[model samples]
Target: MSTVTLQEKKSYRIMGISLPLFGLITVGVLTATYMEVLPKGMIGAFALMMVLGLILNEVGNHLPIVKDYLGGGSIVIIFGSAALVTYNVLPESAVEIMSNFMRGEGFLDFYIAALITGSILGMNRELLIKASVRYLPAILGGVAVALGLVGLVGAIIGYGAKEAILYIGVPIMGGGMGAGAVPLAQIFGSSLGVDSGEMLSVMVPAVALGNAVAIVVAGLLDRLGKTKPNLTGNGELMELENKKAEAKEEVEEKEEKTAINFPMMGRGLLLAVSFFTLGSIIGKFLPQVHSYAWMIISVAVVKALNILPREYETGAFQWFQFVMTNLTGVLLIGIGVAFTNLQQVIDAFTIQYVLLVAVTIIGCVIGSGIIGKFVGFYPIESSITAGLCMANMGGTGDVAVLSASDRMKLMPFAQISSRIGGAFMLILASTLLRFFI
Candidate 1:
């Protein structure tokens, strides 16, 4: 008899399903979708997104150069899905379902609500207050430098300084599409007596291209941090000199001791939704501020005042971890399929246009990094949150950029840049159009 019995093969999985089973499920889903017999609403939408997202994510993370420097799976998920849609690789019916689920049904909002509520609630109260006080100035520094640099380059390249600032610089830094560019198009149209659609035509490409650049640069920055460890705080945004390292260690120890509680995650979900609801209600009253900004403020206030119990805080953190670990790939798929327009990005890739966008991003990085250092934050973290976050496409862009940088903990600051910084751009654009137009 043979001395050794046959060894069992190890199973490989994607999204928790073993490879063989997952392949069968993927085939069935695609067949159903192709035949237009896929179930409607969340059931159909979630299945398709999950399948596409996991496949793309796995491939992206494994590619050699792409994994090392090009934002790994995060970049692949967004642009890969965008290319699929652009090339008609995905069925139109399937695309429509994904779009409706992501935008029409507000899946992005639900994900962001949990992230913001949980992230803020779980933060150290002292660090939160200290960082929040200085964050706005860092954001302003990025905006100022990005716009100025783009305008200077535009004039040098004969692209027209004022037009470059208005079209390229402002849109790139104005947050994302809905909160930033759409409103900006309306403002520009009314001021210049042109159609808002025309204004959008020019701005949309800038947002898309800027978002792509932000993701790439974020990945590069992460690599830079690894090579030069002093440049980054890992995930910690600021250096709290007065705060003892032992205290942080103690907190981490306590966190490790707390086992994952299913009921606690349920409470976390409820809390996240409730805070988001409160933000919406407040937005109704304060129409000028974005609901996300209000939500950040509300969460910070609750945290600062110690209004919530410790258990609830831990619960929120647990929920955030769960969503971040599992749903990020799915969300990236939604963003690519729904928000990105590959054709627009390609059409806008003139030498001058590329240079202008690049200059804007570089300026943002330099300016925010310098200012952020003065205010006690690590340069890499500041540039990612205050600089690249501002230049990327609003909420979706924030997630992508942070994901690329491996700094999901900075969600609170990224939201501030997208919502508050974007709101500021609208005001600036409104004021500037008066003179330029």
Candidate 2:
């Protein structure tokens, strides 16, 4: 009986059940809604995301060619699902339901908040302090190189260096939506005598395209690290001789009754949420800086002061693992369905335009990796934070890129790139727009 039970567990019928059930349920819900009373609320939205997410992700991760060059299942789920809506492959009612749920219902914000809290609290206190000091230079390096390379590509393709930098490159390399393009549209409007809406129309495409490319490149980078063997710390940002120290810590841990319990996970969740709340509260008072920046600051201070004990920290780590393991897929689908517009990417497609954006992302990776190595950080880790984060769509982009790279623990650096590095681009845009104009 036990042998039979084990065999059943390993059967394809049991293992592959999730994908089929997801499809059947999603179709049933959407069809039922169309036929009669609509399941047109949060429940319906979640249903679509889960079904679509599970199916696309399974293919992306399992397919040999796609898992390699296309940046694994996460990217597949995001862009493929996005293409479905963009091309109108999905029903109007289905699209509307998903869009309303993702955008109107605050799904993205909730996901980001959870991600930020857990990643920050889960980091090593000493490592966090060390990494924060040097990560900024890498971000600046990415920005500088991206601008230069993109401008050069533009000139070579007859796009003109100055025109390319102002219209094409700047927006792609800018921080993100709220912090990047929205304000940049205003800057272009006032300084270059272009309509803000027109500038925004140009900028949003660049942002979305660049973000998509960044996620793909990150997967490629992870593969590159596996091949090169010396470029990454696996997931660690530093290559310090901490092995002995880690071993000693492990020995110390064994002496104590330190096992991960549910209470610990709960405490971690509470701590993470509390910090997120603090950042939000601070954002209301000081609207200039993003809530994430404040949250990082608060968490860093708490870690620095040794206010939190080892037990709480462990709980936070466990909770973080749980959240990441479960929700990364769901959120990626939300980004694709709700946030991305495949139509814009398709419309903006041109050889010269594509080359400019491609070089811009490459420049970011090369610039940040080299600078990060020089400043005592892992090259792959640095690029993921400084380059990929800079190129992605602010917070949402940060999560997607990081998830694709399989390095969610690096969320602090990613946020720094999106928030602080993004702010720097705003300043650079103001200064450079005049020269271009």
What ranges in model 2 sit over 4 Å off? 1-7, 12-40, 87-89, 133-140, 151-260, 369-437
Across 61-162, the per-residue lDDT of candidate 1 in tens digits comes to 799866644445766787798899989998888999998888689787787777777766766666555445788788888888999899999999999899
Model 2 quality (TM-score): 0.64
- lDDT by residue (194-311, candidate 2, tens digit) is 5554566567667767887898999999999999879998887766664334433321112123566999888887887788789879968974445555665676677667788878
The number of clashing residue pairs in each candidate reads 2, 0
TM-score of each candidate structure, all chains considered together? 0.70, 0.64
Off by over 4 Å in 1: 1-9, 133-140, 151-257, 372-437
Model 2 residue 82 lDDT score? 80
Give candidate 2's error at residue 297 in angstroms.
Answer: 3.5
